[model samples]
Target: MLQAKMKNGQLITLIHLSKKEVEEIKSRGEEFYCPECSQPVLVKSGIKVISHFAHFAEKNCSLAENGEGAYHESGKIQLYNWLKKQRYEVQLEAFIPSIVQRPDILLTLYDKKIAIEYQCAQVPIEIIQNRNRGYLNAGIIPIWILGANKFIRISQNRFKLTPFLTQFLHQFSSSYPLLLLYFCPITSQFVKIQNIILTGSGQAFGSLSVKKLYHSAFPSLFSVDNYHEALTYRYWKREKEAFRQNVRGKLYGEELAWHKWLYERGTHYEYLPSSIHLPVKDQYRMKLPPWNWQSRLLMDILHPLSKGHVFSIHKAKYSLKKYYSPSVHFPLIHSHGEPILQYLHLLERLGYLTSISDTHFRKQMIFPFYTNVEEAVKGDRRLLEVLESKI
Candidate 1:
């Protein structure tokens, strides 16, 4: 509601006018209304909040629900100004007639159109997906930047990533890691959560970099390579130990069933080898936890095969139907296949499997099973050393 249409059909932006000029307009009894809906709106000039036009309380406008208090408005205005300063063509609260959706800010570059959504409030994942679909159909790339105030900081390089928040993550390219973007209007800082590695369903360790809006440009957001490998390894070691120690705790749903399945195979969950549940960047996209899917792969597919026996991707995907998530579109990120493939590749890199073809892989070494948790931890250390060398 930063820009409203005057009665004469001229656009008036309250933020551009001085306080004295805004008072003069109000004293002259000028009438302004919403630019999109063309409904009567009143200019609100308050001491605490930014000055803007608001629709009547009884009127329901599409933008009203997505609209929020001054914090959200200020952030939208700031982002719009920042993009404009970069010399990109920008529009505020642009209503795409074809999609009937209004993005907070729309930008048109040389040959590409992008929609920037500054989300300051929590919304359903379904709504987010729907908006993404609409943008894709219209040939516009949608970008979501969350409010930094909502970021739950757990440690220096870790944060609690809720299922709801994961829907907003973006991946610019295949080589780049999945990233979360956050902006703080209060401090004019942008926090990019880069190189994310999920330690659990709701927990992840990553590098958090905060820079002023003016200090970083648009392209800088796409290139994020800085990370702490030693810190990540230490964190993963701690998580592996916690997983082994917490095995006897309460379980539910697929987790409980998976444990029972392991028992039927004459093996305990804690005795599973370290190779299972190893780190994979795309593990977050799976329907089941790493332990569930990884254990299933070993117990059902890889362990039973004789030396030199090969398995195809189709066989792997079908055998692991229980771990497949419902088909969901992840914007800008191409999940190569089931996340288990990444784990298989890691095993390949460790000299256990060899890639014979695009769809088939041959088993080289027999599955390694540790006798107890102590041995499993040591195995993980060796795995970490190999992984570090590649990194």
Candidate 2:
């Protein structure tokens, strides 16, 4: 502990120590615990002026692993080497002022200064907003070079819009040109950078390559407006709306058959009171016939049916076919009922069919002889027809 002389002529231990003493402590193999948290400090030692220590295990610690410090150190070294190769003034990880936050790099070009950030992960929206505000206040242009993981790692080939991401993208869509750089792990350097348009939904539009660097790849940048436009154009080109419209049109044709089938079935049975009800074993077996040659042919023609409806049909058929046959698996026949009901529930959720209420069925089933079999047949036929067309 370092001792200090107080004005009151009292000797006290000074909490604030010099950098040299801190270094000496580290060099002497003495663990430097955080004075604030009392946790072991992990130090990245032996630096050409870039050195810091902090608690690594604490989740709330400012130095928690975000790849920022490592990226900053490696980025500065890389930028310094690049500038030296280009015969330019080399200043790595320089500090700037606007709201008092220092950027990763400050490049001096003739009479102007440029601020650059090497971001390897998705940064918090607040941080990005703050950086933008600071850059604007400082009157220095800010450039962000994002890693490949942001664009290339996403599996969706077509762009999609989420409310939050869309808002974020729209905010920066036309502000500044974005530079996308691909880092090479082998060389521990950025191999290529390209200017890419980012849509209002954060989709990559197109790339413009740069080839000026010593490596085969060079870093590139794009204006925000161009990025947004390009992304919108790409999204429109995918044309999912047209596909949905086509599906809707085909569905309209088969709706008549389904209406007929439902009307003919009426609501005489207890299960028919609610569309959500599971069919009783005997009722389910008697209602639908097994998959005969004709039915099988029709199902084959309607190759692509909704998964829910398909499950219902297959379950009904399996249950009936196995009812009287003792040799057939009982579990397999009973197992299909749950899946069928689940599928019906899904269709109801999607707004394709209405639930059968007690009142509606009671009115139709007033007379014992008054079975609406014709309507049910027509509705079933229509439904099957529509499913066929979809397939």
Candidate 3:
């Protein structure tokens, strides 16, 4: 906790308090109380840790349970002071009485109140959801900024997307690209992952941007960046090959069922069509990985259809509802449309299906199948070439 209330009902912060002021404050013997619980708090100063308030260990306050460490405490103050310099009305560790929630930094933009939570520690998804619900009920928008230590960068544009990290993904508007924000106190760097494509259950590729916190402004966080289609497909080629290795590694669970289903279809993993696991921009809506549901649709739905046979996405979605994650699951995204619709469009481009209507498509040609890995790799490259041209 960085803020405490004086006996005179005045709120004071140790964010910019000097050593002399700290000593003077301790000498005065004035009592300082917590703003959240209204309990008496002690001023703590150390050689390494930032000077701040700490509740008594015996106290049983909800805020005391948070235990915001030195990393979170310093980062919160840094962001608060950074935002304050831009002339934006920013409040540090602002406690909202109506919601019984305290955001690390609360910024007011006219009528809109945005609660910025700088979460350095890993917390349960339910805690995050409950807090967000409380803030939204009070008509306050909540933005969570992760500590850069959680940013799992596997390559230049590639990263691991764990279930915990997905909650931070934000899509401000329909026209804006989805992104997540990351800040590191030690490095003083801010990382923005924009235009992310969810390729697997836990893997994603995105346009990554890193800049010093001092070099950035508040509005810059929402700035849209161009999607690198060439770069995506270039790296996707490697991921496509990795997909083959991954399937062989999995021996049980839903993947085993998928393999058994494929076996019944008179085909095996290596011999399956190259079109199975291609990228869908809106794939986050799917509960399963891109390969699983995409393979299911390719085999069960399209493979049996004769030339000119029409299929509707609506019916496909209903029949395969279990594969889809409900729209409500993505509270931060404004609109992702449909992964199936995008997949259909991709098939249309690849000559597997022809458009009949917005909801319907006609099968034009049978999906290509390769006998071996060498042939499959070539087919994948051809499809990627088509994608690159379209991009």
Maximum-TM-score candidate: 3
lDDT, candidate 1, 192-292, per-residue tens: 98888876568888888888999988878767766666666666776777777764668888778988898899898678877777777776677777878
Q: Model 2, residue 131: displacement in angstroms? A: 1.0
CA error at residue 132 for candidate 1, angstroms: 1.3
- Those runs of model 1 whose alpha carbons end farther than 4 Å from true positions after fitting are 8-10, 27-29, 36-38, 58-60, 227-235, 246-250, 325-328, 334-338
Residue range 1-391, candidate 3, lDDT tens digits: 8889999989998867997798789788889999888999998886787989898776777668776688888788889989989999998888898988889899999999999999887888778778878988899988989988788888898898877788778888877777999999998889999988887758799999999999999988888987766877887888887776554764778878988988888887777787888888777778788888988888888888998899888876776688877766667777867888888888888888888777788999988787888788777878888887876
Model 2 spans > 4 angstroms off? 1-42, 45-72, 153-202, 208-213, 216-391
lDDT of 2 by residue, 226-337 (tens): 3323333233333322211223334232244433444564423211211121112122212222112112222232223332232234433354353332311111121223
Worst 10 residues of 1 by lDDT: 329-338
RMSD of each: 2.7, 20.6, 2.1
lDDT of each: 0.81, 0.37, 0.84
TM-scores for all candidates? Answer: 0.89, 0.39, 0.93
